[model samples]
Target: MKQSKKIAFVAGVASLALLATGCSSSSTAATGAEGSDATLTFMSTEPKSITPQKEPGSQIGMALCANLMEVNSQSQKLEPLAAKSVTSQDAKVWDIELQDGWTFHDGTPVTAHSFAEAWNATATGSNAWQGNGTFVSFKGYEELNPTDGSKASTEKLSGVEVVDETRLRVTLNAPNADFPKLLSTNPTCPMPESAFEDLDAYEQSPVSNGPYKFISWDHNQQVVLEKWDGFKGAEGFSGGADKLVGKIYTAVDAAYTDMTAGNLDMIRNVPATMVDKAKNQLGEQALYEVETASKQQTLQIPEYVEELKSPALRRAISLSIDREAIAASLLKGHAQTSDSLVPPSLGSYVSGSCADCVFDPERAKKILAEDGGFDGTLIIESNSASDQQLVQALTKQIQDNLGIKVQLKPTLGTELSERRNSQKLDGAVFGLWGWSYMSPDQYLSQYETGGDGNTVTGYSNDKVDKLLRAARAEMDEAKAAKLYTEAEAIIVEDLPAIPLFIPTDYGLQSQCAQLNDVQGDLQYYRAGYGC
Candidate 1:
């Protein structure tokens, strides 16, 4: 269940090895109390990589590095972190001023140059960082990853104007109203020159500027990070523990066991089925429901499938699946049946609610009958056993409601992604792999004509494309939100993608160690502050 760069969005489909073993009752874990030197042991599903700019979105990377802006998990608001201030009169041009007296774990002064170098390297084709999608907004992004098969001509981005040691200017390719929110994400966190000097070594123990500094990483075992005494961030003043030690767990059930028994300080991603059980057994105070960035389970209906091309048939299929039933029965109320592609937790939430999204077996059957009844077997593939189980439940509902023959195929997570990317599947594909950012632009752009998340499904609409482009270029937040909402309404009606539910993080935290759920990411540092 190790986290991978590509597999992060596999939707909560982890193998929960539920062995009939008694829980261990150990109470010798360290608490995040002020003036108490403690090491918080966290049970983590291992990250695929810890390299900055390469796998910066990984949980390990987020825990170690401090970005220009820090997003409040609850509010989804961007606050200044490394940058003292970020100002923009025109959305395309932004001036970023770094906070004075901030230093990496290795004692290197964090400068504007550090960010420039890290981003430029990631954008370059030779680096092949999977996170390069984060930097596409940069002015010279296309030059770094040229479509013409030419080598990158520059080391520094033309849009980034270095003002001084503590200041720089960023020029986006187009006006993006949510540019500040983009900078707040972990992938945009600055990396010291030391990381670029020896990429492999940095991955092992990256010099960090956050509340915690990387100490050591034992692959597939544990990653150790100690509190930096010289840390000057706002989170540093808050009551954070002395150290963070992430112990890798192969299964969520085992991690949950350890956490409940007090052997581990915290365990993330408790299985959905176990939510009620954990809450009852461990007490509500011990159970945490963390709001993660909007990860909606969706069915990507490929355009290649002729039978699925019928709007009425697709609508029938969508209505046939009982999302609320699955959310309550299978998910144990851990998720909500989603109406819009954009989760309501975000800023640009659009209420795309419709009668079409409502489950009506009789209406669905009538619709299918009108569209020349779906007689062929509909095959759906998923990565994990849990997801397969969920799909099986949905397929059963489909068969009973719409009288459509359905098949559920289970594949390895990586294999599923490969098949999805290659467009090898003749049927529909389902996954949690969508936008990590809170922007409506990121959400809607997935279905844009030949966009990054669009190529697999070949789902496109001219109206949707026009609206997305306008939103992308709009400097006003209200105008962009309106445009995105208009586009979402069109897509929701067409039924190119069927939204099932929005994913929420359910976990357990010991009384000794606080669990801070920041924008869906569980953090021990925020627990220290009791925010």
Candidate 2:
């Protein structure tokens, strides 16, 4: 979901990159011997901010902050990182023990106080950090959000107690089985106290506590990181690469060209247009079609759009579109048709496939007619150029099959996000929605009443809300899975948002390092040495 979150806010800074001239069509890769000398250059969209606690989590954020815990891509289980071990009973009171000798890029020792200070600052309202919402489960975290329009009540979180340099205790407001998984997020990554000294400057050129240290950040251009010899993650993190460089490509075609020329060691989220060609050009060894838990694109109908609020109408709309055709022709068979809101990466995931997900134009027409069929154009909003393509394809299919007038409206991601958050958007919006971690709660909780992820659909179901709450409080994994299954059933029945495709990541990587799945993302850190 970090990629989706990044896309949701990219409109604010995309214009800058769009305005600037493109980089050299083909650049030279840093040539040197193997190991640390072997640098990996990546071409991706620029991250809006890299501030550890405040910025939207993205690949850039992941590169900079080593979280308290890390998720194994293959197993979808938690692995200790900064915190050597975490123990919790009753799913509320948790004790964390940090691994000794980890240090910030600036050579400052990381401690329990570092995390406590960072999380408290991030949870405060005055900082305007988007991550504050993630910590609402912590006890006394409510104080960080003053009911009044004043600054946060306190900088010190009553929930977080630093017992000593290596030990800390956390108390949550409610029992949450996924609390440890939550700590794996970038927002929860600890930052040195000095990060607060100049938040703005720090965001542009932040120090990291990860395997790589920040070297330079050329705004709107590129970010450079080099292996930190002092980094203690050698035992469990990173591969043979000594340096990692992330650069912005004004055009995907340019990125593809650079990847072919070996200027870029890899390029994530490969453009659909180039997926097939990339596979052929890079050969099977280099091309990777990594499956992700991202709900890449979804068709959302807000409750405010009165005409489309009927459950029957929503189902009709969902059934009218041919998802398989879209995946085959438009996506070039690189996409997975998603029948459920939660991706199939988590242990509790269900396909949610039923008569509701099947494509049947006649049945759809009958449902819509019975529901007193529409007379107006359905306005579908697209947040990005890629999304606009998908929206355009959907509009054609929905209009052709349902005989409903569909209008494709393109808008900047930021503007659309604003409209969504304020509950001002009507009709439908086809955009990004995904999970950042491997938990059903990440997807189910969003459907809770007034949840941030529910912005597009404005969906509310008492059964779903109650089931999600029960799942969150459930200490047993099996019980939680059952609760999630029940909640998912309720949501798919409501049909507020129609799942389109489970996102896929396509990239070309040299054998120098193998790609490892980390929480559904195939990242370089987990790569094994080869080339």
Candidate 3:
């Protein structure tokens, strides 16, 4: 997703896709030759794919590969990695000066056109998903008045130009003052032209250009990366740190088991089921954190043009959730019930809908009885939990309260993500959409009129669109935040979704390990950590 301008939180969500897919490391001599001491053991629920434009591909991809730029976690700032610097003189144009001694894994020198070509190729359709909604807004990719397709094809971008090997130029249809920050995701991380004899194949298994290179991945089994000495670095690196070693596992139990045996040295997530035992076992090596959960469980509404636009229904659904029950049973008190679409930890609330954004099963029943337009078939949604736990729980609550029998269905994580994106979600899907509290991009375009990432709910409003555009356009920090607050109030009234608990990322880790700054993302298994 875009870094800060409009897709930051969405990028956090995309980067976490591997949490569902599930990393490998070598043992250091300080620890052993197994790479356990030297490597970080990571776990992801879903398998990762190799598309720069895709979730794992776009943001933070530089940890494994290099891009033209990188985002600094401490400052929430974007800086050049492959490029020397990027400056936007105006809203539509940016001047990027390339770094001097950059090279790909294959030793091909980095070029301005490589970045431009990569952005151009992955700007539409599925590839667009890779970049976390970044270049989807580029002017060259916009197919205005195309006779064949309704939307523009990202086939050949017309806006980005290769001025020279060191400098590149870009033009936008709309004024995007935050363009540089948006390109900080992994997919936008530049690659050497040498890695791709065929662009499609390269998308499947990309070679790294960052501090690390892809070693091997066995899907549900293991994934690995080795250091790339060719990487060009600057401010983003931890003082030119040595190459990172990563390992991913599917089950927390397996990961925890290995780490406790001293076979694993670093992991961001400490296994919760055995946290007590591990705490006794590893002692101070077992670090504890009151971390924030990036995932937000919201009821999705269709962006129906008319007819079935039901805020009341959305409200009723929101009210039906027994958040207390979910927190007590599923989350085990590790989750915080959200009061707004955007979490409050950002030291601010975006929505003014705090009045009805809460648990009220009885009220939900009453609202549905009076206002819901139920079409007979039981509506259900799902995610990557134990046998549709969330779906089943939601169905039981909705039925017990409203007398509507919803047929719940469970699905794989990737499939569930796809259902939301396609928006043809039959009767509605039950799941969560993760957002970043530290960055603003996730909120701005996420719920806009045409925002693909905004599909969290089918519901959208014209006035809401006006609010989004206003917020995005405002350069004054306070004024833009104020606009967002007002817009949030309008959305709360609209009830496209009801806020649910913000759950924590409960992964098992060694006590001394620390992993943060993945944009509040959980399940960023590939993220490196140390004892």
Candidate 4:
């Protein structure tokens, strides 16, 4: 759910490349008054799809549709948004009751059927929606999306049943206490009947029920939204901006320049090269930076690499890199050195879950020698321009510390993703994972054998697989977290991927607007505007 270095990966499936989330304003009108008309603009890359279920993590989708559940920005707790309540007795069967009077932008009523139909369409294998993996636990998901790549036997999930216009019942394949957390995702948002009538047309101008409504989409340029005055949710238009405009820019530097010139209102990602200068240039009030809960930078090593399969060799490579130095000097303190696979934002995270993650060149060299030293060059691949510096720094550290020739290969994000999907990535790949919700399961589930996120690394441990499964089914919140923590211990021991850093989410605001804390999805929502 978290945006990758240059793209968003939904349940480990790579989607379109997206810019970091931030909003800017083109209008200079002082419009913070109760009903004053003002436009707030934001930086974004062109979205592949605006449909909520099709591209759940899209900034456009997040703005246009209200999800069943949303994370409280301050508390970081999952709470109801569109849905009045999500209740279950056994955690396997859930009943969702929608808040009455919620309507789509097109004036159509949002009902239980709206959610069921949208979910069914997303689950259908023939549709090939990237968000399909989110519904794997729903009963009949296998029939809808067969792993063998054959035609699906069913189009709808048998577990999702509309009890009435306002209520829906869902039965999962297993008891999952974290099921409610999943609802907070954009994919779970309800769709209007008009969307199903002609999906392609709907994608172009989606009829959503959120704080904003679709206005126009200038492809490769911008997508515009007007505040939906009929929004029934408790949170709506806090910024007082009448229009939310997402201006697509291929370069972050350009956006930052525009922001500095006062032409743009806000920007979520300050170019890595300009991170240090941003505070001095914009002042402390205008610059916002916080440790993100959903992001973790890592280096993934495929198990199929015979010469590097040894856990000791992998551990040595991890130890060789100086994460603290890179985060402080190279990244300008924009990132935190990570010791565990899970970020500290999650309650399940243990401070020192990854013992091998520490930097110890001597120990690394000793381990490499004991495990039969690696022969030949260690190639680390990355596609993102933002990650190039970090990747290069890592290669240098590995070479200097471990005494192995290291190469940093820069490829296009799309090409790198293809190689990852095909499991053809050779030595090591620099990547990052972002989560849509605040849950430890999002981080740990990727290592499960034959799991959605396991396609790239091909690292599988029977104990880890079992632990993840149990964690998914465990009803007790603390128990589920413990299981995930235990699994992380084994995963670090295996060293399929080395946790490197937890980067901070950065934003710059103009004097005209106020920015809220970055949401779990790593997007900055407007809290207020019109200074």
- In terms of TM-score, which candidate is strongest? 4
Cα-based lDDT at residue 333, candidate 1: 79
Whole-model lDDT per candidate: 0.70, 0.71, 0.57, 0.76
Please provide, for model 2 over 195-310, each residue's C-alpha lDDT reduced to its tens digit, 9 standing for 90 to 100.
Answer: 87987777777886986778888865888877667765423344445677787765557777877777777766665656778778888888776655554567777888887788
Residue 208's lDDT within candidate 3 is 55
- RMSD per candidate (Å) reads 9.6, 9.3, 7.1, 7.8
TM-score of each: 0.81, 0.85, 0.79, 0.86
Among all windows of 10 consecutive residues in model 3, the one with the lowest summed lDDT is 21-30
Question: Mind giving the per-residue lDDT tens digits that candidate 3 earns over 1-531?
Answer: 544333211223322432343322211222434444345554445444654556542222445556555554333455555666666644566677887767777677778877876676556553445454566556655552243656655366677788998888777666654565565556576656754577666645676566666666566656565555565453223212133334455444566667778665445434233445665777744544535555666665565524336777777767777777776665556567777877665433644345766678788778877884565655666654332454566678777766666677666666666676666565565555554224454654667665536655645678877876666556556776777777777777776666765655444445323444445643232333443
Measured by lDDT, the strongest candidate is 4
- State in Å the error of residue 176, model 1: 1.1
| Candidate 2 lDDT score relative to the true structure | 0.71
What is the full ranking by TM-score, best candidate first? Answer: 4, 2, 1, 3
lDDT tens digits, residue span 1-531, model 4: 632121111210111111122333322332655646677778776676777777666777887878887764543455677887888766788888888888998888999999999899987868856576688778998898677878888778999999999998999987777787888787788888877788888889888888788999999888888877888654322245677788877656777777888778777645445777777888888776655556888898898877778888889998898888887798887788999989998878999889988899999999999987888888888866356667878989999999999988887654676687667888788987878776788877778765656767888899998888788777667888899989999899888889998877667777766666545443434345665
* Candidate 2, backbone clash total: 1
Stretches of model 2 off by over 4 angstroms after superposition: 1-36, 72-77, 146-151, 271-273, 291-296, 303-308, 383-388, 411-427, 450-452, 455-458, 510-513, 525-531
Please state the error at residue 422 of candidate 2 in Å. 6.0
Error of 3 at 488 (Å): 2.1
TM-score of 1: 0.81
- Candidate 1, poorest ten consecutive residues by summed lDDT: 6-15
